[model samples]
Target chain A: MEFSSKLLENAVNEISQLPGIGKRTALRLALHLLRQPKENTHGLSKALNQMVDDLKLCKSCHNISDTELCDICANPMRKTDVICVVEDIRDVMAIENTASHKGLYHVLGGKISPMDGVGPHDLNISSLVEKVKSGSVKELIFALSPTMEGDTTNFYIYKQIKEFEVETSTIARGISVGDELEYADEITLGRSILNRIPFENSLKL
Target chain B: MEFSSKLLENAVNEISQLPGIGKRTALRLALHLLRQPKENTHGLSKALNQMVDDLKLCKSCHNISDTELCDICANPMRKTDVICVVEDIRDVMAIENTASHKGLYHVLGGKISPMDGVGPHDLNISSLVEKVKSGSVKELIFALSPTMEGDTTNFYIYKQIKEFEVETSTIARGISVGDELEYADEITLGRSILNRIPFENSLKL
Candidate 1:
């Protein structure tokens, strides 16, 4: 697309560099900013710049944070001895929203994807191992997504701390609560059947 | 969704304020930016702020431009006497891509939409009428979208310029070039038949 103004073209180019945003969408967004009050654009720019420049990761969990430790890690009531291992802060937030996991989180930052040149060494795995070796963590739940990389990361971490006394387990794999059985993928369906719990256990929830 | 960082939340809120973007998409975008180099975020913020602070509208046609006159308005090769009226710079860019029209453009900024509290006075209509009254323009082609507001805007401009010696016409309404006849909408199909040009006229294109 041809832009009449150099500044407009620059803005569109920068915006389209974001994931999932195209040139057309960038143009629309740039035009929307142009039509809005100057303060709105300035506010957005300020917020983005500030977030990128000053945002922190929790020293304990490696989750995105405003301070040295994230709120979840800092909360005294949260179960520090039980840490939930996940891919990123988004997963941490998702699990937090459900209020199902009272444990602290250990964000791996990303999965161990050899296809993307990301290895175990590049993740927060070493610190997690250190935490386990310190003998403070009693249980480390693997909460990454059900993918090849997730399984690989989980196995890799499990191997690192297997000698320790910490109990290791993965989150349950099952069909969604409201989904039809026929619509469930074959692997999930098979796993759900294999991992079926007692009827009494199901009622506990 | 809960954010561990205040800056992250602020950035997501600002990004979500853009049209069609929701909270989830905003968070994804923010996280993507965070994962990238600080330079990417800084570049985007700088570009947006610079554009909002420095971008200008063409003095003659009101198209978004870096200078007083837009490229089309400044071009000596283009026909200044035949002006194409459009809704915004997007339409200007769309028509420019076709390379069919050799005339200049008059951007109305937006259409007459009462539902949106927009009217002729809210647009650049008065300046367009003044341009026609100046007598340099011999023909004005209304190229607004075929919507109720577009029709109202076209008629409003036509009424304002009726006293002038200049001629006024709306772009032809018809089925798209590659569309199937059976799938064509009733109004468009009927208008195409009613406004059919001579066989020889069609051959000229």
Candidate 2:
């Protein structure tokens, strides 16, 4: 009774399995697709099929690519000495969009999570270590989210590569960003206090 | 800069062409498909292709079906004497879900709209006329929404079939339903008054 046709129901079920989508949204999407022309639907189907067949992880950076190396890894202008490490390919894309950093990237595929049965061996940590051990890389920036799992992954990787001569650092965390002191979270306030910068030229601290 | 990957961009563009889906939503859907297992994406693609290849319009009622005749048209229990004309198959399913109507259906494919270049000939109006001329049907119900185009289509069809010796009627339209009288629009209030039912249970009015 919920859906008009079995095909619609099946499509909705498949769409609902995606991240951030539910049954209602899936149903809406299905109805929308059904209203489109057959040529458009054919194009959508072909595109989906092609993505499944053509997409593969780069051997070097573990980022999604059609070839052995991702675009970032193949780019000559990118700084090879400073490699930014991220949990997923989407994160790599996010940083790439900023256009501020001109460094190369190494996608971790996933972070180490003991509860989820994912460990250091499961991720591309060994490859990262090997990349650092080659003596070409100098600094490794950890651009991970401020979450418990992210912290755990960061500490795990940090411990593994501490013996190496490469410098390790994480993205700065504190009062983000045009935030008033009254609305700032306790952890952010505390971190900002602990890592306060010296006020020299303008206002006296 | 438009899209990171050519394959992903193609997929997002194709999905965005579907009705009611924008570029951002299409990207979300494409990314969702990318994250799914290969077999799941294959199934979705197969389903979409199958729908395009296997689906056909029924010769009898013009509803979508896998066979020459739709399931509803072939059903013996459904009353052939009453035929409900609708804009699309979705409307048929909407009425069928109510479980009140026992009649057949005729999908017009779309309503008449000169602005969109959709005319009387563009829709399955000829097929509907032929079905009416068969003399098996006694009543034709216009179950279209209260849109200007729907009204125009209904009037056109009514003019075509008025000469035929059959009962012709339309689904009631007035103040809908659970609406407070004070908040009713002037047009709806006027229509409600014109079509108001008598309080007395008289055998004949």
Candidate 3:
């Protein structure tokens, strides 16, 4: 799109650099910004710059945070002994939102996908190993997705810290509460059947 | 969605303020920005702030520009006597991209929408009237959209400039090229039929 203003064109170009936003969408966003009060642009740019500059990674779990230690790891009420290992900060947010877990998290940053050039060393496996080696963590729950990459990362982390004598378990794979068992994939349905828990355990939720 | 960082939360809130972006998408975009190099965030923020701060409205056409007069209005090759009226800068950009018209533009800023509390006084119509009153402009083309508000704007402007003795015309309304007649909307098809041009005129392009 030809822009009469160079500033408009530059803003649109920078905005379209974001994931999933095309030139048309960037133009729409830019025009929307133009129509709003001047303070709106200042607010947006300030927020973005602050987010970038003030952003920090939790030293313990490698999760994105504003401080050295994330809220989950810093909370004494939450059990640091039980570390829920996951792929990224989004997973941390998702699990925290559910309130299903009362433990700290170990964000691996990404899965160990050889196809994507992400190896075990590329993740936070070494620090997680160090945490387990400190003899404080008693359990490491694998909450990564059930994909091959997720399983591989889980196994790799487990192997790295198995000698520390920590209890390790994967999150349950089963037919969701509202899902039909028949519609579930063969492996998931089969696993659900094999790993069936007591009726009272399913009643917790 | 709960965020671990206040900066992240603020950024997400500001980003989702944009049209069509939701909370989840905002978080995704914010996280994506965080994952990139620091320079990327700086570049984006700088571009947005600079765009807002350095922006200017062309004195002649009221289009967004870097100077008093927009490039098209300032161009000596373009016909100064002919003015294509449009609702906003985007419409000007769309027409300019087509390269079909070589006339100067008079951006009205917006249409007359009483329901939305927008009236002729809210737009840049007075400046346009002054341009027509100058008597240097001979042809005032109504290139505004076909919507009710656009037509109202066109009619309002025509009335304002009619005493100036300038010729007025609207952009053609017809079935789009490569569109099926059966699938075309009723009003557009009817107008296309009613305003049928000579066979030789149709063969010009």
Candidate 4:
């Protein structure tokens, strides 16, 4: 769209560069900012610049942090011996929200996707190996999504540290807790049956 | 959702304050920024802050501009005697895209909405009336949206300018150019029939 002001065009150009935002949406948002009090725009820009300039990545877990270590990795109460390996920090946040996993997280940053030109070296796998080789971690859980790339990454990491004395496992895969059996995909349904636990085990949760 | 970094949380909070953006979407956008190169985040923040800091409203039409008069108002090619009154600069852009009207514009900034505590004083209506009283304007087109507030605004301005010798008219209200008759709203279809021009006149376009 044609912008009367050069500054407006510049702002819209930058905003639309973001994922999922289009030129039309960027224009609407920029116009909305123009209509509001000056402080709102000032606050938005200041916060964004500050976050990018001062934000830190956890040295241990590879998760976002304000300090050298993320809160999860810094918390002594969490099970440091068990590290849940995942694709990105979003997964870390999702797992954290559930409060189900008390173990530490090792964000892989991204999975090994050859199609996307992302390989094992592109991930945080080496540091994970170092963490495992140090012998502090007793167990390493593969919490990556059940995709081809995820599975490949998991296998690659397992091969790297298989000689170590750490126990390795993947998160369980099956139908959702409240989903109908008929709606379950054939692969998932078959897996659920093959990996069936004792009837008593289902009642534990 | 819990954030590992206070800076991340602050950025999300500020970004979410924009119209239609929620907390989850805000976090997604902020994270997207973080994942990109540092230059991307710097560019976004710099553009946003610069636009808000240096932006100007045209003194004549109140369309956003960098100088005293907007490009259109300052242009000699456009007719200054005929003014198209609109609710905002977005309308100006819409009408400009049509390339149908070559006259200047008078932006009202916003409609008079009592439900939103917006009155005539909140708009640029007085300056518009003053423009008419100056006797330089030959005609004024009411190009506001076809809503209750739009109608109220048009009528209010009409009462203010009736004493002047300026010709006043509302933009045509009818079915859109490509709209099917069956799907056309009752009011629009009825108005299209009532305001039907002569067959030969329609051929002029």
For this target, which candidate reaches the highest DockQ against the unseen true structure? 1
C-alpha lDDT (0 to 100) for residue A28 of candidate 1: 95
* Candidate topping lDDT: 1
Q: What's the lDDT for residue A179 in model 1?
A: 98
**Candidate 2, residues B1-205: lDDT per residue as tens digits?**
3454778778878877765678877877777777677888888777776665566678888777767888898999999999999998778878988887898999998999999999999998998888778788799999998899999999999988888878988887787667888998898789878987777843463
Minimal lDDT window, size 10, model 2 chain A: A1-10
In candidate 4, which residue ranges exceed 4 Å CA deviation? none
For model 3, report DockQ.
Answer: 0.83
lDDT of 3 at B96: 90
If ranked by DockQ, best first, what sequence of candidates would result? 1, 3, 4, 2
* lDDT tens per residue, model 3, A74-160: 888997789999999999999998999999999988999999898888888888888899999988899999999988888888778
Evaluate model 1: give its TM-score: 0.97
User: What is the fraction of true interface contacts found in candidate 3?
Assistant: 0.92
Name every residue pair that clashes in candidate 2. Answer: none
Candidate lDDT scores, in order, read 0.94, 0.81, 0.91, 0.93
Error of 3 at A76 (Å): 1.2
Worst 10 contiguous positions by lDDT, candidate 1 chain A: A65-74
lDDT of 3 at B164: 81
Residue A65 Cα positional deviation in candidate 1, in Å, after optimal superposition = 1.0
Candidate number that wins on DockQ, 1 or 3: 1
Off by over 4 Å in 2: A2-39, A111-122, A133-136, A174-205, B2-4, B173-194, B198-205
Question: Chain A TM-score per candidate?
Answer: 0.97, 0.88, 0.93, 0.97
